[model samples]
Target: MKLQPNLLLRLGFRQNARLRHFTGVGTSLVYREYGDPQKVIVRREDVIPKLKDDQVLVRMLAAPVNPADINTVQGVYAVKPQLPSVPGNEGVGEVVEVGKNIESELQPGNYVIPRVNAFGTWRTHVVTTSSEIIKIPSDVDIAMAATIAVNPGTAYRMLKDFSPLNSGDTVIQNGANSAVGQAVIQIAATLGVKTINVVRDRPAISVLKEHLTKLGATVVVTENELRKSEEVKSLPQPKLALNCVSGQSGTEILRKLSPHGVMVTYGGMSRQPVTVPVGAFIFNNVTLRGFWMTHWNKEHFSHPKRHQMLNELFQLAKTGGLQPPNHSLVPFSDYHIALKNAMPREGMLCKKQILIF
Candidate 1:
């Protein structure tokens, strides 16, 4: 049958549509040396990034400025990239070009989120293996997708890995107001498990409680409340404790767990050691385990499983159940100003900040 050439163009589409493309022709953000957050050198210029045959080129749509990302740029993070390297840890993008072999797995126009620690996600484009970019649901919020790769994934893994907690089981975590903590609360709630959340005192305690409670936290207490509340002492002990705050604050989280409970420490934001009573480990059979998202992502999951996990996370995001408290969305042009405002803040004001092109 003979086809009419203009037929497709007439079906609500423009025939000569142009998509903005990026190449190594000019510089994106790169660090020559690490110093201060404000002064850690970054240069913008054009230099072609080599791509593997199994890789794809992504036009970055949006990226979040995570604490880890900032730390890496400051050269204080655990995993440091080579000098003069790009320094973004996570971002969402649309695949613009795909290599031959990965054609079945990825294609142009697919939305994806790159794995955390695969730095350079902050650029106008990222070249990465097909296996590294997790295809996200297109209808999912780009801002949410940009922030999902790390906190939500980490929380999912920690809950599943750190011991089996069935419905009705209780878990406690300090720093429960953190992104991961909020995710943990909602995910656990969806699984029918309960959460006891602990947070540092913020300006508006009642408002904070309402927020976490709505996210399915059964109990939300300030550190001070946790330290002295007789009501909390009478409550049922948690089977697991997730600690991000360290030092004495973390130890207090341990005190709320039942005997034989496991405490998984994923972050040490407090810069203090997690001190537990010697008896908690020796007599109570409490276990303290460490979890690093990078190490777990590397050692535990297969490529296919990792991809499936990402799909599940996006499904959660689609329902509006999983989300970071969005602080702001900055365009690619205002990246400098956005980066400047990305400092650690307090209360709800300290929520996640996403950089959107």
Candidate 2:
């Protein structure tokens, strides 16, 4: 049949429109107002809208409850979302359907993760534009893939961007037992950089030190030990210091820097300001900087370096060079448990909580 080009185009559009008509309902955790995450966020089964020509329907596999997610819900994070929002910032999912006009490489059954924040990943399904998500290796561990975008990416960027580190170069950091801290130790080790990890002294300090050591930390010391330990003093002064626990701990890390060193503060677990000594800025020529992963993502959303870093992290996860931190998987139905476990409790070490569908 000889058809006009315009008629052919119209027919194609109709077929694609028919494909977009399919719809279903899915579970989501929604919040109408910012408050306590556990208080305001509630579960609801909402109708999943029909797919648009450029969108894909993803069936979520798992998502983690991060501290930032809690802060966002509490209206304390630097960036805020409009009310009646979903909470998760990152997760991994499978593409169950694709709109007929999607031009990207995404396809049914491909694994993907949101490339940006505020994705509202704490849901059973989502219909997102193909451009908003990026495909991940289907073979990688789902839990590791779910977490790869943030903590490990933070570790990777901090090491590569802040300094020109060579093999045997030393880096010092507090919050050594944190997820990001663990990532720092492993990534630094892979680059042949030595890390002097610092953590608060706890009842099970030995176990914690041994665990970090096995993950490639060159040295793990309690906050008190960091000040007086001769072993730490024997190592070359670190050219870089990572501060997540700002306050007295941050000050101590600053005191240990080498000449012309840089200290990059990425977190304030202590909720205190990073106080730099006058002598450090004047005498040693050290620089103090801050990093927010969310801000970094906004700046580098389309930069090649962002994807390059992600690919490297994926390879590390596949090869076992990078491992997901201590975590406990809670069923999606037990979201309350996940929320409760994710909250900070005095004197208790909390394992990351992942909600599995």
Candidate 3:
């Protein structure tokens, strides 16, 4: 029998009685020009394009207001989108309608996440292909599912790729309170590895330390404290260092690594280049490398291990071994508030804000 596109969509419309099923009008946060996100992001609504035989229509559930999303909007990120682009990088979405000829692997009501880094997600709906998205467990926690791409995925890869660590082994990282850093702590805890998390001193230092400690950080200390404390000096030297804040903060963490240690640079929050003493590299034989989740995904998207890694992470999330980052919600209409919260500011590091459709 010949396939029929109109009838397939017509039947899908009958199955799901939502109004958008027909009109395809949906909202989005768009930026025609790149700069500061707070000034450029605006709300727009339009009819979603018709789906190709391989495409699927998805209703965005929740999209994270990630720092990378802000950086991308500023035109400073390593990866930049074409002009007049939609502005979010990661989120969980529900499959609302599938193209008539789409593979049975994707179906209406299934959950999915973007398959690539720059698949803009700050919208109420998305029209994408089976090749552009990967199915996720429908019952997974929304917040956790929305954020699994960049942050936790980074932590998981760094932990596995760097130094050869085993049960009872130790790793240290700067930006201890960051989403990725917390994932490091929790993942290490689950694997019987220890984490020494270093954060900058702030008024809320004690509270942050307490929170990270509860997440299984073996030791949480300020940059200043890490440099001066005898207590920190007593623990087993770390074989791996994860640096998100490059600057003296990264140097402080790098200086604490054990001989033959490896430091992986994944982000530069402090906007300062990583600096280390010559002796540490020469005598300690320390190695430096960098990891960008974007690049990794491009290289490994079809690798069998990619799914294995995600399965492990999903298991952790389902079992409560891994938790989502602390975050506040903003309805899609109030995206400006989420954008503003994502910017760097005084006071102390705070929870990320997410856009709820």
**Candidate 3: C-alpha lDDT:** 0.85
For each candidate, what TM-score against the reference? 0.87, 0.93, 0.93
Q: By descending TM-score, how would the candidates be arranged?
A: 2, 3, 1
Candidate 1 lDDT over residue span 1-357, tens digit each? 111336323422232334322333433677778766567646575554545567787767888888887888787889888877776778888876666667675777788876545558767766778767677777877777787778888888888888898988888888888888989998888888888888888778888889888888888888888867765665577898899988888998898889999999988988888888998878899988999888877774456767776878888887876876545888766777667777666665365767775
Candidate 2 C-alpha lDDT tens digits along 1-357: 122335324423222444434455688999998889889999998777778778888878889999999999999998698888999998998886788898758887688899878999999888898888988889888789888898999999999999899998999999988889999999999999999999988888888899999999998998889988887988889999999999999999999999899999999999999999999999999999888888899999878998899999999988889999889989899999999899987555579898887
lDDT of each: 0.76, 0.88, 0.85
Clashes in model 2: which pairs? none
Candidate achieving the largest lDDT: 2
lDDT by residue for model 3 over 1-357, one digit each (tens)?
A: 122346435433333354324444677878999888888888887677767777788878889989888888899888778989998889988887787888888887788999877788998778888888989888798889989878999999999987888998889899889999999999999999998888888888888989999998999988878877776777789999999999988998899999999999998988899898999988999999999988888999878778888889999999999999988878878887887778888647688888887
TM match of model 1 to true structure: 0.87
